[model samples]
Target: MAPPTTTNSWQHPSPHLTRVDAFRRQVNRRYGLSLETYHELLRWSVTELEAFCRELWTFCGVVCSAPPERVAGPDDGALDRMWPRPNWFPGARLNFTENMLAAGLAAHPDAVAVSACREGGAAWRHLTWARLRDETARYAAALRSLGVGQGDRVAVVTTNSVEALLVLLACGSVGAIMSSTASDMGAKGILERYLQIRPKVLFVESRVVYNGKTHDHREKLGGVVAQLRKAVAELEVVIDVSGSSWSDGRIKSLDNFLDVRTESLRFAQVPFDHPIYILYSSGTTGPPKCIVHGGGSALLQQKKDFILGFDLGPDSTYYQYTTTGWMMWNYLISALSLGARIVLYDGSPLYPSPDYQVQLLQEQGVTHYGTSPKFLAALKQAGIKNMPPLDSLQMTLSTGAPLSAEIFEWFRSIFPSKVGLVSATGGTDLVAGIIGGSPLLPVHHGELPAPSLGMAVEIWDANGKNIEDTGEKGDLVITKPFFSMPITFWGEGGEEKYRKAYFDTFPGVWHHGDFVRKIVKTQGYEVLGRSDGVLNPGGVRFGAAELYGIVDQFSEVQDCIAVGQRRKLDADEQVLLFLKVKTPPLSDGLRDRIRTTIRKQLSSRHVPAHILEVQDIPYTMNGKRIENLVKDVVCGRTAKVGGTAANPESLEEYEKFVDLPLVQSSAKL
Candidate 1:
């Protein structure tokens, strides 16, 4: 049997929606519907939206084609086939990293560019628009000599440093494929991703600076290098940034690698669809899919999210808590396109103390910030105080999973009322957000501003048909293929897997696999919990947020996970509720009350038949709950759990729980 159903102890459908106007109508018209879904940024003509996109593309040198609305079989008529084929800037050429680098340095040259601090009381490093550009050029010249030519792959096992940015942009300047894994990941984890790409040159740090201390990365990195040597025949140059001692045949200090380069070298330019970076999926669904992004598509999407979505500009200074392995690090680095400073941190946001990152924000007066809800939740739990006043901040962005309203309100409460949360959403595949907050839109407590300017986002029923009911829950689907869609799966030719992953579920549409709702709730705006992660028992459904609210309210329950456990004998599976709390000889009355409260609040059907206690809940290395991963584990599947994911040992406890006698009794429930 799989687990039973349980919702959060705090969430429910909110009825607070604002009055609608022409803006709402215009929003629907552009995205393929005129439904009264609540949210700001609904007002504006499709022309206005198109105008926004065109300026953005021109500004960032991103090439785009029309949305994927008009795809036809290969043999379709000329106008129909060729017209809708791929509308990118077919005749134009540009560099992917150039756009991001240009944004912060070249185009908008006078921006307050970057400020970085490694650990407690470390010397701060700041870079202006002009300085960052020159550094990138130096690195570009350096990498070009290492044979990082167009179409070649360069991988990095490193930390968050300016050199990392230099390397990414340098590779882009010459059209080399860029791949990176964060420093903390185990050697095996780094090898898994790198082996797939079979990179020609690797840039690795001998060590990493974190939490005011240095860790010897070489111990694990050496193992990784030896493995790569066995798998890839072409892997040659190894650029060591640690300045550590090494005499391997292929290894050389980055200093010497860059020493042979000249000052006046030319940067390589490529066609719009040229591959520039390789990013893997979250692997919650299955094996990580290696999605290859083109220079043009990445530039457009990154520019759209950073510039218009976050209201970034020459005056903007952006901060996002992220790393090389996670997509946000890639997304955050694109703020360079806005000609804004990029704040990159290598330590925990709450390191040395609960207010670690908050101090940085206060010290720097960040203009724009992006982070995850899991990070914010930890801040709340730690009771950190007087976070640097983000008075200079224009917007805050959150992504990775559904950001609860509780978190939204908590963050807003700390800042002024005018401060808005962008509620960003997207992944490594798109290279940025598909939906983000808008400055022009009146702020909503938890909803994203609107669908991305040119993206055709829709809520679809199980059959892949559009759902008209405002509050009806459905799968999030794209009626048209947006420009940011992956060109093709990396290491594979053509679009077979691309089509299979996004289009096979539906005949013509792209399925995003998120059970979600696009709605204009109580205030004409709402960002709801994931519907795909819903808990259903006997066909009665409840979202994770809804169940979490009820069970977690128990003082004894520190944290919990709610999942629908499939039963072999019964058509309707049971709701398996796992609670992670302090073990105790607590009152049985308290446990009874917890279950009773859920039955009363949701329904008897919503109550989990079996509520088992565990020592801790498993979370990805990033701190978010690993729902599907744990779900896969309970079902006896072998998953390549990544090294970067945190506290994997907690997952082992969950595995051990199955042997406990309590599980059999819960099974009958």
Candidate 2:
């Protein structure tokens, strides 16, 4: 890999004092070996997988009713034992909610466990650990009275509020699996997912506040519950969180749903692989797939990432801006395992003021902040400047999409010099980060610091040969399974569908679908883009991120999406680049400059055949550009524009480009 430029390197202020360094010392003393560097520790983690997991389990203080006899699977083979679906800590018994509550209460029962607020609402409402435990106890008792028990599914459609967190914990306390989606999602999208799981109880928010609007979902909720009751005979109860009166007699308000007669909490100690969460695949191109995750694996892996990777502790305050729809919400919830205070916001960060989130960071004294590249770019676009130092903010993590080098510099330019900017990559498939930050590593521009420990991450060519050392872009694959792999998919033929989705691409290895390369010099990785959406024009393949990074430098472009288009009758694929500009009428001068910069920075092959301007770019609910969906539209294919899209109507504008004269001429026989 080429060396990081002088401007690209951001050195860590204090490496030795980091939690990873402290862990390294513990590892050295216990293992009777000297592993000096972060890279060396990472190597030992993947190679001695069992030892590393055992160490991590003890270090994180995982609260369990019964400890496992061994850290590896029961078959005594950590690798090649049923391959991808193998279990970890086979004989262990634990309760997910118990662990989180224990850690929180152990720190201090009176401390704030959650601080939540809404857009255009009153000041933050703090929920102490004692109050959180009480709420969970009451909810669990109510669930039990409703016949919810071990293995039952409880679904929630709510905002990122204290009530949602309480419902999740209550479900975990009873060993009932929990699945949730944000209230902003249309009823159809919500039904499509909940229908597959057939949850026993449903929790729906009556009102939602977003983008400076209060959306009342009374009619929508009635229609959804009516449909769900008809289809799912097992779905017996509906609870309204916002206390709005509903016409359906089956719906009960939060005050009415709770069992006032009961007060104590009882945690169900189930097996190690007991299912706790059911997440869905982003169904941009098709129906969303339901993925089930286990309690033990989710607890161990996420705690490792939060405590070790981000160096979070009991005194730290973590604020991850997310909705219930995204996996980051689950990751954020896991912060409680460290007894750390967490901030939960339900509406747009841009509302009230442009720098509202920055102000929250300073006010909350957040030690770790989780966000995306889009928000940072918006700050720069809004001309936000001269931010005072936040002495409490230690690290800022960006993950929804790839963070550009310019954004990295922009973060450095705005934040305090001591704050480390982490550009990490992971997805919903695992419900955790595969490659993220480490306090011991330097922040290189446009690169993630390292692969998460015990992930066994590597880059593989089309033939499944490891090419990570070659410094060549390839598929990001996991040669060995880690703790957080999904336990199973939720319904009929689910296992087959799951296998086909991930393992079918490369047989046994976990194909993560990201196009990336290893920066050998810095021991970091540059995530190019999704491998499936790679653009191939003239038989030369490259990631759209390469083109986007250059085009983003242009002041005229506000947002963009690059995709390859090939009609059914066409022999060759052509590249189409769409731009959303700040000003109207994209001038020829700006287009020529964009093309010139792309051609100069990248090869001519990387340049798009058509540079068109559009009013908006389609994005998923999670803030990812819908490139594949756009590709389908421009190629004249019928696309399934589902509720996963944040703005599905934006797809209509791309249909006009199907029969462009240049594109028609470029199509070879």
Candidate 3:
């Protein structure tokens, strides 16, 4: 992949940034606290934050302390040299299920935890903590009856239903590692991922609804499950949660799964490093690294993020726009530790109407509303000019991609100015944010502040040189280990490949694949974009990958590839795309779709608002379509193209048009 430039993306706002002075003024007006006083409240020493973190752990019921026996060589501090690498509760040993069970949800009695959201455009049904916990234990009993043990892996393909969340917790309680994907992924998408991590028991949902349409998993599940059974002999029972027919193991009510375990709860015990979940990234080659996070790490880090980062307390109610496939789903559910009510929507955020989310925000009294920048931009362009007052709202966290200045300004001007617009970034890799906006700081336009507490963050150049003194951009890197970082990748030869993935680049430091500036801007240093996918147009930096993800959902074309082509003589870039059409050839109608999609789905910056159509789209062997490679050829520059094509080996197919006159003009760099 080529390094980033702003051709495909960038905020048009001038470089006039709010440095330290202006930031201090915004703080005083909003919080009734000056920057100095607020800094006192926010400033944390390593020792102090560690203490607070432990308190959070205790509150969340996670029991981790250094084992009494001094395990030689790999002791707590000696385990590794990296920062934040699975700092387990150093002195205690406890079961994962026990912590969640001790949540004391009984006092809240009728307080809702898991609320079932059906795609039938129907109202939601809230599950009380009492009912939620009972159901979870019941599922645990059922899985145990099916012989699920502490070390086995239970795989699931599901939607964001109460059942899926309950099942994951159930697996954790019983010591069975949980791995799953959203029901919306296609056959190849699901199959390629599931095949790598052979789950012992498979849970498949029959169907899920998005927008106004319903999609069934029957076609893919049958073939996919068949293949999974072939790989893992331990694969025995199956649970179908879709509420539809076509099952392998006697159709079990997701509700009934809990019924079989009528006895008093029986939780299991495992090591601190026991695997909990297997999350995947959108990479092609070498087996989708099944990122394995530990039970201890997941619980503690989650508690830290919810309580500290977002100011989520026991009384707070939370909801984020997410699906089962996204990491936010996992993060959202963990907030249950705070005893806060979590509102889940299974259908598209804009399904039925664009006003759906605003309605939820007002009705649910959602204190922490997390969503993507794309969604907010869509709301703006869709003429959703006004919204129900979020009187009870405390924070609005935006992730999934960078928040453009226009989208950010819209919130400041049109949305609730009292509430903070927290643009946070963390991926499935760390299971937490490297740098996220905290309530303690003022929200700036299109930038984030300091790293989450305890995250030892630094930015490094290609040769592993640290970019100090703030304001300089470089590859975002983590200097030390912290809890919640993936312990390993499943199905790998060993930790060898896992280590190679993040460590090989900068030797000992963990090189996170993001191009960021460690600027001591108003708040602090923040990450910029995917270092590998940043689009450079002139001198601006933009995240092209995020731009594509937001723009593709516009429905103007079936799919699109946005790449910034570099010209030798010019100091700028030309943005191009290889689009696949579901409708007819490029016409005014199609162009309108492209423009509207970007404007409605994202801000004008992402619209590409300029596009091109190519006969064939080139992709890597693993199905990842490469945009940088195409851009390289589009600039009339020689690329690795001269070599054997990665996938669709028909290099000739690309050459036929890669240097074509029509294409050249469309993407003249």
Clashes per candidate, residues 3 or more apart or on different chains: 46, 0, 27
Residue 328, candidate 2: alpha-carbon lDDT: 95
Candidate 1 on 298-372: residue-level lDDT in tens?
Answer: 776777666555656666678888878887877777777666777988776666875777677767878777788
Worst 10 residues of 2 by lDDT: 660-669
Candidate of highest lDDT: 2
Error of 2 at 407 (Å): 0.7
**Model 2 TM-score (2 dp):** 0.97
Residue 656's lDDT in candidate 3: 39
Q: Write down the worst ten-residue block by lDDT for model 3.
A: 7-16
Local accuracy of candidate 3 as per-residue lDDT tens digits, 90-167: 434556655554563744857766565665336588888778778777888888888888768888778788778877
Alpha-carbon RMSD of each model: 6.9, 2.5, 8.6
